[model samples]
Target: MRPDSCLSQVIGMTFDASVCDMFCAWGAGATLVVPARRELHRIVDYIVDRELSHWNSVPSALAIVEGLGQLVS
Candidate 1:
């Protein structure tokens, strides 16, 4: 990841996935974008608005987004 890469922190800090999210960005000096409460319901909008370059999450989380028809090519 580049220093300017905007990586999304979709998982909570309590979860193990969050560790990777943080380290991946911090290790490479990239930007880690954490979503707010309001933005949670509109993940796609937040992603676009934030211009996220990377998103890290579990398969189920992705399934939720895909099921919502929010995953665009």
Candidate 2:
């Protein structure tokens, strides 16, 4: 799919220097959510609650989700 056509795609989790790529690569309608606090539980909660469409980050992030028993299948 052409990134230009992928509008309304939401992305922007962490700043690993790829945020720009995330927005440009995925097109518009994507807003980066920089958590007010760097709390693991809070972040995970949001991720699970919102059911964020796309999730891309380091392994540690996934580890926290698993540790909190939040990974859904």
Candidate 3:
């Protein structure tokens, strides 16, 4: 999708090792929320509570979600 089209979707993106890519994405108008750690429960809670539509994370972060059984689709 076009970057401009994602302006309305509040996206929670993790910046563990890479900052440039994440920053560029955020600069394109995607609302970004960076958590303190790889806390899947907290991340999911934040996303759900804030009604976020997208997220970007490392594979390890995805594993956390899987381990907690909180993967949404």
Candidate 4:
């Protein structure tokens, strides 16, 4: 499926779902993944092991990702 389609599926998920750190990109729907904090590793692992994609964060978070080299693309 297209990236947008995958993102749409993610956004339709219920809030109670285990996923966290939802990022919405322009011209596309939301990309769901877990935050990268150590405490959130389990969730992050789950998303990464599943090979899911996510939108890049904005500003401060983006800087963090860049520093950590985890920025998508």
Candidate 5:
């Protein structure tokens, strides 16, 4: 089980995700995670493509995933 990082932030915060990742990386000192986009399909694709077992995201994300044919129960 891997925790794939989603680099999503408010509309004006472009570098916040990278900054957040930097902190998360510095605390552990490694790049075990990769940044992802905030788009509907892109976000869902990350979960499905990476085969992630767990995820925490906005309701829109789940709705998009469900609309795209949810494979999980």
Candidate 6:
């Protein structure tokens, strides 16, 4: 990702994926957007509205997004 990219910080701190999310974004000099718990229900919207360029999360979270019919093709 580019330095101007925005990365979604969706995974919890306890998860290893969160580490990757943070470090990757930092390494790339990208912005990291961390949504509040209340905002997670519409994470797809958050990602789109915030213009997030990268996302790193567990499979189940992705499944939820896919189930919502919001995962991009």
Best candidate according to lDDT: 1
What's each prediction's TM-score?
0.82, 0.48, 0.47, 0.27, 0.38, 0.81
How many clashes in each structure? 0, 0, 0, 0, 0, 0
Cα lDDT tens digits, model 5, 29-71, are 4333353444334565665665544344445666776777854
**Tens digits of lDDT, candidate 3, 4-73:** 4221222333534356445655777655445444433566776676555555455686677678887778
Candidate 2 wrong stretches, greater than 4 Å = 1-18, 25-27
lDDT tens per residue, model 1, 4-68: 89998878888876898789999999998888778867678788899999987777877777888
lDDT of each: 0.85, 0.50, 0.52, 0.40, 0.47, 0.83
> Model 6 off-target regions past 4 Å?
71-73
Steric clash count of candidate 2: 0
- Kindly list the per-residue Cα lDDT of model 2 for residues 1-73, writing each as its tens digit: 2422222222344555455535654465454344344434565566655545455555777777777787778
lDDT score, residue 66, model 1? 82
After superposition, candidate 3 runs with Cα above 4 Å error: 1-17, 36-40
